[model samples]
Target: MENNRAALILAADNSPLQVGPGPDQSSPAADEVVIKVAAVAINPSEWKMKEFSYIPLKYPHVLGSDVAGTVVKVGEEVKRFKAGDRVIGHCLGLVYGGAKHGGFQNFTTLREAVTAPIPDAASFQDAVVLPLGISTAAAGLFDDLKLQLPSANVNDDKPRDEAVLVWGAASSMGSIAVQLAVAAGYSVITTASAKNQDYARALTGGKHIAAFDYQSPSVVGDIVDHIRSAKGVKLVGAYDCVGFESSTRACAEVLHELNGGGVLPSVLVPPEASSLPAGIKAHIVNAAAPGMVAGSPGAAVWREYVPRALANGSLRMRPEPEIVGTGLDRIEEALNLHKAGVSAKKLVVLL
Candidate 1:
């Protein structure tokens, strides 16, 4: 890659993300495509990567996961994309290749499986919200939970007898999981504050079993009771999107009480197993997990479903994007703002 600039750290010492020349990149792998990044959404991990040296990155590293941009180069084996196509990619820079693969730069490389074309009607900022959220949720539902995959066609059209509980449905990852579960024909049970209950339900197109108030002390019982009240619906599993100890406990408790014990996939690292209820299993969802295999649930979502879903309005841009500023220079400010805490909005930097 040439003529690329990036918001990267000089050292992983709680350093600022400074704009500078990008790391040099060699030719892309056969399954990879190069993107001219136009917009990127920040994640908690991005800030933590510096503040805590959470990942122990190489010096002058770049950290980004959510990306939306135009294709500039394609590998010979890449069949779905070419130069000039608009797309969104789940860049694995911090987790995979150090600086070269990061999305903070104007140019980033993405594997075909984790990349998808965005409809022309959609803006980069709007589409940028999908990558990490979609990847993390897909890893939880389709990979970890091994739930059925979503579709743009008639696949899994019949509703199943099982239901899934999504804790903190108003959050970014939870919202995506809610829609994906409902789209896969499993009724979703979710939790949000009283004010956002309707918003969470709306994420499922009103197909969710219920959106309980998470602030209520009885939320766990409420979710369990609601799931039990459904005539034939079984509580198959739960995803703690918030991943806090309390929410994790709530989900595991629901699973143990309702399903007698089940697997729980969480967006954050779960509490220690010793502290959890007996028979409850927990999995930490890695956004990069889905790209590990061919024809994976993530593959189906990004390659087979998302494009058509976005085009037809079946999928929505949830926890809508709030533009932090234009250009890579603002990524530090965006990361700091995100670290301080943002509710119901994904911070974005446009280039």
Candidate 2:
């Protein structure tokens, strides 16, 4: 049914996803563009929401975020896209609340602010990885951490005397954070497992000031000493992409020792308040918030920066895509695999 005009629907909390009728062909809002979704990328939130009903959601809803495909139609107020345009968008079914905006369906509506045209070099499968990963990264880097925004022109960068710490840089969201920070001309300090250390560094084109092995017991000391004694570059803040207690604690402690205190934006939940180091704090970031509002940092990145960066090859679809299967039924298998855990790659389902 995903091949036709059908949806992968969730009937109730903790229920299995069922292939069913797609959303009705309704008139899109002035800023919305409907797409024939060619590919959808899986995120941890999708599986978690279904298994635990973690987020407030209506039953019989569709859940997904990352989408890449051809624009089938656009509303009157949408000037950037026309039918047949190849594009990628962050679907907010989870946020806007319903099946219509969900990416798991064959066709879905996405806001123009969060949608960007894809270049010929970026395939549907490849570009699908960008929407949520890059959105979350932009949200954390710009809105949450209040760092300088990224420029579409990489050469326009004036290197800053600061570095950002991105824990778990090989994950979907963290990888983009590393690249976006470098794109904004800030040197990055990243940590990943040995298998992903090189991957994380390459995301920033080796612009990283230092990279660390998360498995090493000396990692905290290593990060501290490197940031402290470096000839230049101060630590502005840290981003905990892993969201585990250990990752958040490590980042909080590093910020406490180096910067006296700092804000940390996490992918999921932050550490308990009682466990945080003095003067250090962490907050969870929401990628959908920026897209919902016009002229936001997230909107600008999605509108101007994404298309340009993707066209010029400054942004590579990283952690890479691990194609799990094709079609609606295979989505469940993909979800299971994503739940099992992946490293240095994203799970994608082709429709």
Whose lDDT is greatest here? 1
How many pairs in model 2 have backbone atoms within 3 A of each other, for residues 3 or more apart or on separate chains, i.e. clashes?
0
Task: Tell me the deviation in Å of residue 182 in model 1.
Answer: 0.5
lDDT of 2 at 267: 91
lDDT of 2 at 210: 66
Candidates' C-alpha lDDT: 0.85, 0.84
**For residues 1-351, what per-residue lDDT tens digits would candidate 2 score against the true structure?**
233355455554566788878786457888889998899999999889888877777767888899999998899999999999999999988888377888887888898888999997788998898889878999899888888888768653457788899898888988888888888878788898998777877786676446899999999999999988877778887999889989999999899989888788999888787789888768898888667765569887887788888898888888788898889777888898999989899999999
